[model samples]
Target chain A: MEYRRSLLEVRDLHVEVEGKEVIRGLDLVLHRGEKLALMGPNGSGKSSLSMALMGHPGYKIKRGAIVLDGNDITGLSPDRRAKVGLFLAMQNPVVVQGLSVTNFLRAILKAKRGEEVPIREFREMLVKAMGLLEMERSFAARYVNDGFSGGEKKKLELLQMTLLNPKVAVVDEIDSGLDVDALKIVAEGINRVASEESAFLLITHYRRILDYIRPDGVAVLMEGRIVASGGPELINQIDRQGYDWLAVKTA
Target chain B: MNVPTPPLELAQEPEELKNIRRKAWNVYTQAPFPDRASTLWRFSSPEAFWIIPENISSMLERGKITYKLEAPNGLLLSDLQQAVSDESVPVGALVGPEFGKFEALNLALWERGAYLRIPERAKIDQPVVLRKHVSGEGLVLDRSLIHVAREASLTIVEVLEGELTGNGNGYLNAVKEVLVEEGAALTLVEIDLTRGTTRAFVTARHSIGSNAELKWVLARFGEGVLKANLGACLSGQGAKSEISGAVFGFGQGKSDIHTFHDHVEKRTFSNIVLRVVLQDRARSAYTGLIRIGTNASYSEAFQENQNLLLSGDVRAESIPELEILTDEVQCKHGVTVGPVEEELLFYLMSRGVPREDAVRLLVAGFLEPVLGHIPGDFREPLDGRVAHSIKPATEVENVL
Candidate 1:
């Protein structure tokens, strides 16, 4: 059997927001080409963990190191982390008034590649990505996330993820507000981007998305720490018995 | 310094204009400096713009003033001084010396001026471009009078560029009066590109006739200190006016802007939108007013001012006021002053954009709406100016 190197490792991570610790002593790892489902109930530090991994200034890492591909990114800025191939699809994307989608996508691509992409080439890439997400061509001209529907915002996130093709992508609640059809499209986007050189950590409160993008491993997070980790059957077990059983076991 | 006597060169003007200049000079010498306690002068000191009498004479003698005007046939475009001597232009029909002290000084000391007239019932598809360039030190005054005849339509773009040389600071006072006749439509764009040891005070007033329309755009990207007063009077029934301004302040720049919209007739409409971006210790103060007269029933008026502070050292103050004397009128005003939202910055930075580029993108987006109101040809150059004004984050530290 071939050896698969771990792409992302979170060791003893402690995160505090506004001086209140939200993520405490959490450890997780994902190997290359692995899809990990991080299941947690509401306010279980799922979003905080994603934010901390992305180096959000507001999410303070009191005591932890986020290693990506053997590089310690604990002290990296958000832009630096992004440049190093760490992508975080925020749950509620902010509205940047007057910034067109086309300009933003081009800017991000240039920032990542460290060079300007020709206008025509960028347009082709944008069209392809938007088409894959089932987005209309007019979406290119619309301001970023301004007056966007929940489904449209999610689609935009997926479009960005597809364009960046990062080594590790933490998709936070990408399927929460999406309908079944939209979920299918999002799942297909993730599946197409999945490769041996990349990994995905899908953070969600429900296992509905796990049905489409079958996870190789499932981890249940409770009270700022992982309580259980198992194979795909653990998802069916949690679905049948609920998280109470896991919470009881952890206690 | 005490008030200086009127210049002796007023004696060289024609009888009619000489009288006007003398009267304006008298007003200029007699009017006391603006009180800092007054609302109009509270944020800015009038002393910064005050010019000594001796410097005014030297400026009149040594200043270099050149202008180019392009207009279609049947339109009258000529030197304002010559037009005044020919008695072909009304000197103070819309605005007079009594309008203010700085206005009086401009009327008395202006050596370079232009007069433009669009003939009645004539429609010019292409815009008339007016370029005025001034280079020198001391006090430079330029005046412009634009009249749109009844049923005529015209668009005028006035570009003001200047460079001040020598060790002493330069003072510039420019006054413009625009008249839109009944049933006429006029679009006026004023671009200010003055830099280097310059103190510019500009005042522009517009009078709209019955059923007339006025579109006014003001773009300010100048260094040093600037005090501008822009006013619009919707005097006739169904008169409409839209005034939009974009100001970018950087590198120790200071700008004080005041706008007034007066709805004087029934069913008249007016709207004003002003956006200011300040960085690197630059400061800006904006006060806008919308007034609806008691007799102007059913009139509508709106005013908005938004300020974006890019650095911690930068300061911005915005005040939008409305006085509606009639119950049937619709009047609204909004004002906002704040630094760039941190969340918005994080959202952009998370996409791999550096902090400086993120700030630039956000500032560009913040100013996009107002810049959208500008013409394409004029907007491109202003974009360059805006980019220049937004310095890197390293230089402007503590940027949120």
Candidate 2:
């Protein structure tokens, strides 16, 4: 008997933006229901990798294969990628006026299922999600990300991640601009949504978000390539020793 | 051309600007120049006043002018020519009956059950509308006078659809009045459709009562030319007024928007946003102004005009001004003319919205702020019409 498993295999991915090569060839893999933390310094292409995987038009994938659920999605659209259970909670979500928060959520759900859910059932699920995120009902009436505080926006993104229940989520700097209290809420939101059924690739510059996520695998990215791969304690070591492990490179 | 007057009830005396009418008409004559100037004109092309022949009676034919309601028995569109029954025989015995042409036009177009005499003191419902369709190169005009009684509410939608179905040019001259009694509220949505050389002049006058809410929304479409005018007076204290507009055109088409908000009493408020998109050598101009009078205090007025140039050949001009007599006020004005944000375009395209859908979404987002001014009843048509106006922007990139 074979056990069901989930995996995201990025074999030699090259990403470009505005014709400039940004993320040079890189390779990494996350197994079913596993968590991978991608840490990098500023401008090291951590966010670009995540964006390219989500099919952001801003970044072009010149080469490489992104296989999720046994299918190569190297050239898929962002929405198409999202439909296949790929999610990206951007550090700064676009503030779209006149488009209510409930609207985007409903649209994503419909796009994924190709059908709308019963209003009552959807509302019930939404209520539970909001309650867990400690969000007020009035927030639902407002436009998507419009005039919301940075922390509020993160919570809302987390709520969406939970509701959509995607197979893979690449979060870019989820802990930025959050207070200690807000950070705790956001981390908890991520924890609540993450399950044994899905895998997550958490990208960040700081080690704070890892406090709650507890990545099953840790990868350090330097100059567009993965420099090291280890377990959770490697985060504590990196935070204290700082990538001196780069000089004693092993092929 | 003569018709009877429906006795206008007057409480406050009219302050005649008789001496200034010449200046107004003279200013109206200097046009075709690029940069829109003057707060009174508000981002409007000064050259637009003469886009159509001033002498329209000589060119129009009765046979070509006809209208019908899509939803039979719901509303019938009668030829406004039939309402004026006497005199004013231009095309001498038109395709329809002889009456006040404006009346006949309204009657023919809205002849069905929607005679909805608005009750004073009622809350305005969503989807407020008054739609009029014109299918000829003849002189098309619509005139409506409504009074929302003290504490009452009302909404009106007027749509000008040109179906000359030929290269023949059409002209539309329209005037509408909204009399909001003390504490009354009113929202009016007006649409101007110009296709194949169609040209039109539309003027609207609104009087907002004390503590009343008035939202004025206008949509300018078609590859034709249009000059839309809106003026409002906040007569009662605490009255608030909103004026919003959008004009989308291509292929040598031109559109102009002129708006004026007059704050007469204390605590009067005004806000406006006019969005324009031009392509294929088309041009759009906006001229707007906010006037705060001496007696007005605590007045707040905001104005912004934004134009998206899709191509280098497309030209967009904007002028926004503010005149405040009382120093105690919060007033600001902004004008922006540029192409769509490249980041936004790339973002949407990355999502597989298609480059065209991406442009459409960006343009639609620019117009989203105006949806608030539209009453619920007119939302569907308003949204539909706006979505169609989001033309590709690259053809008008050089427009500025």
Candidate 3:
């Protein structure tokens, strides 16, 4: 595929973690302001693609190109990738103690942007984000996702995403552990972030989330490769027919 | 940070340390300094022998000691000296031929309070917490006293934290006494996390009144040779006591916890559980005794100790003893010592977690029975300290 002025472009990317290849020459492009949904079954390497792009330690780039904007980020560390406008909403975030959620977001924002926001501005941003996610104000004072329920943890990730606005966001399986009300609030939060200037690659196994947050494009990933790409209607087809449709079409 | 300290040279507490110093030295000299013939030093490393009382007062100059009160009532928080003056308290420092090692303590005991009196029908949910911190080096002598009124409930949490790392020798001699009035409930939780060439001596005793209750938890971690003794006396009818402890000893550290619970009252109850995890060349020992007197009829008492040995060289010994001078007491005792189950480690490794990661989590969760018992406020710091204290199963590369 020809690369346009896309925010993120993964071209023929093959990745391996600890000598085991998980992503084989996968190719996909997330344009600026576009919402691309990557749907795949378990072990289909949906998370690997995001982890590889975010530069997780275990994943090795066997062959391919991961060009963010115009700079190649194939060799960058996860933190560095994060600094350069790349964000990954982890499936299961690491629990860190002695660090409050508010503190973590501020540090992450400062590190990623290379500058710290004033206390008032930070608090204002926090107030707004909490309101948008319907989160209790007291939640900010607690440790980062420490002893949090499944719904609370998912909401926390969305809270981080809302505060630190990135050029490209790769949300991996955000819909897995959310309740109906929480899913709606999270979708509203994600929809507010999605615009013409910011690109989002939302990876989900279920299609129920597609109802709340409309996608500009949809892609099917099977056997570590994108098998199909089409307009918004593809989500409905998958929802009605399931992954079995993708299997038949791919075959 | 490197301000010059007054060359206080800890040499046996000096004359300024006064009476307590004189008695501790006398006991130190007669104790023979844990040598070859002694059973106490049989499993402990010999290098720990150099940790003498030589210059203990000097510790006041090198380390930082800051304390925070547990909460609203402020009660007795840190400053060990203030604890003695708050009430006329006894530190059990009597010079005697039978217990000659504590001769110095009698001289140092502050005679303000005789007992912790909990007024009858006083209901309390707030816990009394004390934090003791030390940095740099030297010798530290700490003490505290607690009294509960009748029907009053209280919890005491003591956290001893050490910061920075250097070559140094330090000794901590801390003693605490608790007096429970009739119809009172007293709970005590102690966390001792100190590393380096340090030696810690902790002595504590609890006295229970009629229909009063006592609960005590002692969790010891980090790298050091620690001698801990906490005991309780049920001196009145219908008094109750429950004791439990967990110790994680690794590297060249040594830990020995000896508890003596006396059931001297009628219809009293008692229970005890002690667990130890030994790694590297470290050594751990748990000795406990439950003595039921002749008049203590219709009473219940139990004691048990378990040990997990990570390596062959790391040895663990347990002795659970019972003295029943009465025929109408319900009592039992048991002891277990062994290595970590290979099947548990294999089960964890089968998942995505690496062997080191798996082992770390296993050891952590293995001790969770005790860790989980701790209240939430101090849980994180305690876990972090334990994670660091248990000899970090995984070594990090100094890439930075």
Candidate 4:
């Protein structure tokens, strides 16, 4: 049997925001098309780790390195990193007024792809992605994330993932503000992307999203470090028992 | 370039109207030009004031005036001469003979103007567009009288544009008088996109009757200096007026807009919303006042001004004043001046948009709500101008 090689490796990563360190010494490895569910309690630095991986300007990588496909992208700008096949779905999406959804999506896609896609091809892909995420057709004309409901925002994030088709995705808290139906739709979209080509670092506090997108592995995050990593059974233990056992083990 | 001397020839008016012009000329000569100490001119620079040029004949030699009128059957649209000569016209009803320095200068030096009178109960479906262009480097004085009769409805859109003819300085002084009778409505949009080192003084004095409504939108994007003053008197009960303005300054441009709302009777309502965006070394100031008279009970007035400073060199000031003398009145004013939110920029950049593109998007978004208040036809052009104004500043290669 052939084995796929690793696409992304986070080695002993330490990150800070506004001079305060939040993510301390973390390591993770993922191959192409693999999905890893990152579970942790509140303030466990799950979102910060995702941001630091995506090269968010607010995050200061004090130590360690982010290697993507044998290249260290730790010092790359956010846009440069995105062009090199990285995507981040923010936990709290910011609203950009006057920029329509279609225009923003097309611009980012152009920046990532290094060329403008034909209008017909772009529209087709956008329409298909919106359909997959259960977003209304009229949403294309609305401003980016402006006055959007929580579920709609998550759906937009998923739609972006489908259109961009990045090599690696760090989705932060995609299931927190979503209803059951929306959660299922979002999960399905992520799963489809993972199955196609992209590897995902799914950040979530609850295990509900795992029901739809079956993770190949589960990693328990506590105090900015991965306390334990195992197969899918770790989620079952987490669901029945909770994070207390993992906390005790880490302590 | 010789400056223009005032007291130009009158275009054949009645004796009474001619006397009014003479009085206005006297006022123009007697009153001193506004200095920095004046309350109305505090934020405005004294050096930017241009005297009325003496080259009136040169201005007439260049045939740069263009007027077009499209109205319903009952509406009367003609030149100012015909309207003032007609017996039924009220010559000095809305704007008095001598209102201010600019008004006096406009009435005295103005040779021709547009006269629009909508008959009682008549409704004009499409807006009447009045576009003016000034080509030469002298003073161009113009005036307009708009009267929406009882129960009538009308919309007038005025666009003033001109180029600097000789030494890169053009002067345009305009006065607009509007009267909305009982149950009538009027919507006026004034867009100034004149280029060059021009100075524009545009003032609109309007009076609203009982149950009447007035919607005014002003967008000042001239390349030079501008002072725009708008005043509305809610003279009758239930009179309402809403005024929205979008002002942009770039490079060395300077713009100031002053608005006043007077609630003279009971149950009157007025709202003022103005947004200014500046970059580079440009400067802009906005002053708004809402006054509720003693008899204006149950009246409501709101004023809000927001300014977006895209660069550190840009300057903006917003001052909202309110005076309430009556009980049971709702009056409030708000002012905000700041740069774009960094978090919003960070969010857009994370989506693969470059830093410049993100700043451009944020600026557009910042002015979206104000631009939305204008007509849909203006959305594209105004947005384009707004985009161009901030292009240079946002194009910096440094993304940090």
lDDT agreement of model 4 with the native: 0.80
Residue B345 CA displacement from its true place in model 4, Å? 1.2
| Each prediction's whole-model lDDT (CA) | 0.85, 0.68, 0.69, 0.80
lDDT of 2 by residue, A71-165 (tens): 78887766667667778888777776566777556655555666877788888988999999999999888887889999998988788788778
- Candidate 3's interface RMSD, please? 11.5
Q: How does candidate 1 score on lDDT?
A: 0.85
lDDT of 4 by residue, B1-400 (tens): 2223646555557777777777777766667676677556888764454453454456545534555665545455588866777655665566655677667767766767888877899887877777777666666677888888999887887777666455644666778888999999998887777776677777788999999999998887645878877899999999999998877787688888889999999999999988888877789988888999999999999998988887788889877888899899998889899877777766776678777777777777777666666667756777777766666444233444
Error of 1 at A28 (Å): 1.1
Off by over 4 Å in 1: B1-14, B70-76, B394-400
Instruction: Choose the strongest candidate by TM-score.
Output: 1
For residues A1-251, what per-residue lDDT tens digits would candidate 4 score against the true structure?
Answer: 55888889999999999998888899999888789999998999998898888887789999999998777999997877777788898888887877789888888888777788899999999888888787889999999888999998988887887887888998899998889998888888887888646688888888888888888898989899999999999998988898898898878
The better candidate by DockQ, 1 or 2, is 1
Encode model 1's per-residue lDDT on A179-206: one tens digit a residue.
9998999989999988989999999888
Q: For residue A107, what is the lDDT in candidate 4? A: 80
Report per-candidate DockQ: 0.64, 0.23, 0.02, 0.62
TM-score of 1: 0.94
Candidate that would win on DockQ = 1
Q: Evaluated with lDDT, which candidate comes out highest?
A: 1
What candidate 3 gets wrong by more than 4 Å, as runs, is: A1-4, A17-19, A94-99, A113-121, A245-251, B1-170, B183-198, B208-227, B230-400
